[model samples]
Target: MSSNKITLKKIAEIAGVHRSTVDKVIHNRPGVSDAVREKILRILKEKDYQPNFIGRALRNQENRKTIAVVSSRVNSEPYLHQGIQQAVQEVGVFGYDVEYYIFDIEQIDQQIEMLYTLAHQKINGIILQALYDARIPGVVSDLAECGIPVVLLNFDHPGCTDALCYIGQDSRKAGRTAAHLAKAFLHGSGRIAVINGYYEKILNIYDRCSGFTAYLAEIAPAVEIAEIVDSSENAHDLYHAAVDLLRRQQIDCIYATSSGTEGIGKAIGELGLQDRTHIICHDLYPEILRMLREGMVWATLSQDLEKQGYLAFQYLVYYLLKGIDPPSKKILIEVDIRLKENMPET
Candidate 1:
């Protein structure tokens, strides 16, 4: 049969399966038996059946182009808002509709549910800040195999082969930068406490801690880590953790590798350590900037989050509009160290 004359329904009839089953096999979606899928593929090859995906995409574009932006809760993260707004502005000019979906990273079930929703949404593409979960690899793999592209924003699943590309900071390097600052501030001999999020599940948090520890060992041999606290992204929890450490050990400096610096700062101030101990944290959030100006936080590492979101959107647009893949699978955003003297312009 001629390629143009052969339809998916005809193929399904010849194979004695439902039309949806044939579609699932053709698109590499799940639920089809391996043997039946092989048979359908062999028959398609023999009949020279080729799908007109470009034409389909053009039609879909005309109807409406949808992209989903999934990330941690935005009400608490101003930087996330900046990134999403940048993406919304750029994609809107091209007539692509953008949708924002917020998830609590601490709630693994909610994160997984939102991912499943995006999977079924049949979106043109996805910009995701995925929380670490064991089930995430399979979901991401299935999405890519089914021809849906995903661009990771800020965080990525390094072991998942299906993640098309990543646009974010090199988290490990940011950690090392924090170590350098700590070494300089303390004259290379002090007790440093490291604060992190859920390290076991979050790769970025783990990487940052590893990077900071490795560098501190290399350059500041006299300095020792007082304690490594896992705060689980909660400011109040971190405050209690910090207060506990302050009572037990002499912490000369604190390095916050993940979120919840506000609580940590509060703990330091209550203990009257803010004037003596230097605190280093990540992000340039309003609270963080306030801490910087008020001399509560000595330094911070800023990842150009808005630019990361902007690039992720541009990559999806190019792929959908011009059939072009990203130039490289790994893209690095610039990581800047912010001090009171060099704070980002408001």
Candidate 2:
């Protein structure tokens, strides 16, 4: 058979399989055995066969496709809720139905269980922001075995076999940026205290802290690290800790690796260190913005929440629809550093 004249029917005949089987293999659908699928694929490659992927995608889109979004609940992270909402809107335009399974990242077992339930529902794809779990790779592997594509949101599942991709910012760079802003505001000589969220569990927070300290060590060695505090995502605890640190140490700068600005700002206010101490933090949450405007917080690193959510859904749709793999294993979003001087008029 001429390569130029190759067709699905001709390929099916050459492979000694039904045209339906060829169709399934061409679209990467399961039910065909691995050996047989490989054989069919080999023959197609030999013939230089190009399937009508666009037509197939159009027909598939006619069916109501289901994509599951698993992330932290709103109370855990209101910013994530904005992302989830954006994702839903973006995917809905492409005729993909999204179902959200909100969970607390602190509840690792419950989050894992929800993943199992979604997989059991035979979801076409899953967008997850998983809590720290050693068993996550196994769970992702199980879903892969069942032919479900998984895209991680705001985090990456490195070494997970067949995990699709991660969508989020370059955390280390954001941290380094925070350090730059802090050093400039403090004139390169100040005692800095680091405030971070669940540093052991959340890799991003750790990366940010690492990046900030690394930069300071390289460039602003005079800006000393007075102390490091892990808030464990508790505002009250962070406030008390911040107050204690302020009262004891001459903390001229605060580098917060997470979104607990409200509590940190309160501590700075109580100590009347609002003008004396310069604080840098992450995210543009309402409270953080308020602090920035009030001159309590110096700068914030924003990881465009809406764009993260929109792109997460968009990439999954591309994979499930056009059979395109993620452009890369990890997509690093641009970090927007917002400060009072350049605060956008919302």
Candidate 3:
């Protein structure tokens, strides 16, 4: 029979074995003897039989699989949401369901509580945007012990060795890239004011700042980081902080490692410092894009938030459905630098 027409029933009949026995051999499940298993395998190899995954999925619909995506409702949430939605559309037909949860970035206790809640609910797998808390490793380990796999998104914790993989941009490299741009814009000898959102709590932001400072120290020693401030990712707070900093000191540039670039732009525009002050920030929020167009911001570094979300969900689904692990422990997404000329059309 043609390979396309071959079925487990036909193979079982040819081998004179029960269909259940054939199924055991096909799925590598225990119960069949070695001799019968070898015979069924021979038939399968000779016929080039292929399992009907869609049919298997349909049959398994009574026990649907669930994947939970937990993240902070930060500036990049919309792009990440789009990616997860696309993955759901592709995987929904295969008896898979996704539950998405967004929490405030500052609420670490709430996030920890939600993790325990999902574990109690017996979620099949999880995709998480981990924070830089000491409690995370133990929580992830407990989830692994419960037979739930986790894929870390955006931020990674060094202690979470039990996680399946981490999928996000290399924040250190992005920070180094930002430093390079700052050096070029300033001719390697200017004072830059650094603004970060929750820098003490977020791992990626911390790494980005580390990289930025390290790179400048190695190559652009003349580029001085005059001040580093934490503005908590709030636009109004960021605005007030930026205004205070710019008014207090003659900053040649502003490098923001988190969201709320609008605040920095407003501070510069209102202070009439746009001609003198360069701004470098992360992500491609709508306001940032507009600022780039009007020359209120100089350059911004962006990563593929959608792709990060899509792969985190897709990898978890692959593991839950097929027992496959991601090929690498770290799946690093590329960082793209955006300027006004290269900005996407609105």
lDDT of candidate 1 over 61-132, digit per residue (tens): 357678887777622245755766665654453446778777666677887687777777758888777777
Per-residue error for 210 in candidate 3, Å, reads 1.3
TM-score of 2: 0.79
lDDT of 3 by residue, 43-149 (tens): 77667675354445434546778888888877777788788778876666466777888888778889889999999995899998856889998999999999999
**Model 2, range 115-184, lDDT digits (tens) per residue?**
8887789589998887667888899888888889998888666577578888888889998898888889
Q: Please report the candidate that would top lDDT against the real structure.
A: 3
Off by over 4 Å in 2: 1-62, 74-77, 90-94
> Once superposed on the true structure, which residue ranges of model 3 sit more than 4 Å away at CA?
1-57
> How accurate locally, in lDDT, is each candidate?
0.79, 0.79, 0.85
Pitting candidate 2 against candidate 3, the one with the higher lDDT is: 3
RMSD of each: 13.4, 11.3, 9.5
On the 0 to 100 scale, the lDDT of residue 192 in model 2 is 95
Q: Which residue pairs collide in model 2, if any?
A: none
* True-vs-predicted CA distance for residue 235, candidate 1, Å: 1.5
Pick the TM-score winner.
Answer: 3
lDDT of 2: 0.79
Estimate candidate 2's RMSD in Å.
11.3
